[model samples]
Target: MIRPDDETKPFVGRWNSLIRILLVESSVKHVARAAMDYANLYDGTSCHPSNERLARETGYNERTVRKAWAAMRGMGLAERVSHGVAHRRLSDEYQLVIPESWQSLPVLGPSGAKFTCVHCEKAFNPTGNCKVHPDGRVTFDLIPMVFCPEPRQRKGREEPWCATEWDGQRRASGETPWSQLGQERWKVFHLARGEEW
Candidate 1:
């Protein structure tokens, strides 16, 4: 499982955010979950696992992984930055994108929007860096204590919800929206909530 405070691999926090708030087909979500293991440390976006590897990891067939990738592309959740060379045995490189639309949705445990920096009042991009100065100036330079979306400075008396908690309880209990519960249960929960499956 990915952890938020794994400083050696800072991308875990972004992957956590992706899984927590993802709203897509359950099958695609499963693929995405598996791909999280391969998120690059430089940024959470660069994923380069082969389709066969992803299929094996997700316990799905290669065909399923291909379809899932197509669905992810259509949904703007991921993009193939480089095609693999079959002769050279290179795997396709994909970048996982956090859609701007998703930034506005309410998180599972809090009323406030996801991906917002408490200090600067600006949304944190996928890089998990906050470039906004205290006086409201954005800078290209790196600054200390400027990480965002996780393990960063937050307002007094408020914190992000722990996504790992209650995964088997509340999400399985059947809830509305059917969007915050991560993978494989979306369709069931959606149908349970009186929506067409």
Candidate 2:
């Protein structure tokens, strides 16, 4: 959570360049921009805002805010510092790490090139052709939408090309993608494969 004192600090000018880069290159533009705005609200290394608060401030739904937070974390722009614990269920704390070192931002992969899945953080190579699923979903050889965490939500959004699966399963259950299993389940899956999240 941001310290009360940090709320009084004015926005720094150094974030201008970082914001510009995010506007032009980030696939999740609104979320990234909103994150910057939230960061600017305080003078500390972290900020804590509920999804409802973020939605109200950014004009995005809570689901979109959640996705944005996930995207930011996957892109190494922000990190979870502490989980919220309360009867009313407060929001988690997150540290915006990008402004401190924007010079080292990860580069987006070129067209048709192998890249990491921004959501699953796995490598994928696209075949350049999309396969239309029966449900009107589209996927590529390198990264199938079935293996992605938020295929429906990411339908028309610009995203990095990459492939991911449930680690050991070649095909995910149609009704329930492995990503919905939550972080603890994924960690167990990775551990079974001798890997770590």
lDDT of each: 0.52, 0.46
Model 2 lDDT per residue over 82-176, tens place: 88876768778877654343332322221213434434655543222223344433322322311233334366685532234344342544544
For candidate 2, the per-residue lDDT at 162 reads 27
Candidate 2: stretches off by over 4 Å: 1-12, 23-27, 40-44, 99-197
Clashing pairs in 1: none
Measured by TM-score, the strongest candidate is 1
For model 1, give the 10-residue run with minimal summed lDDT: 138-147
| Stretches of candidate 1 exceeding 4 Å from the true structure | 1-10, 103-197
**Cα TM-score per model:** 0.46, 0.41
RMSD versus native structure for model 2: 13.7
Q: How far does residue 50 in candidate 1 sit from its true spot (Å)?
A: 0.8
Distance from true position, residue 197, model 1, in Å?
Answer: 25
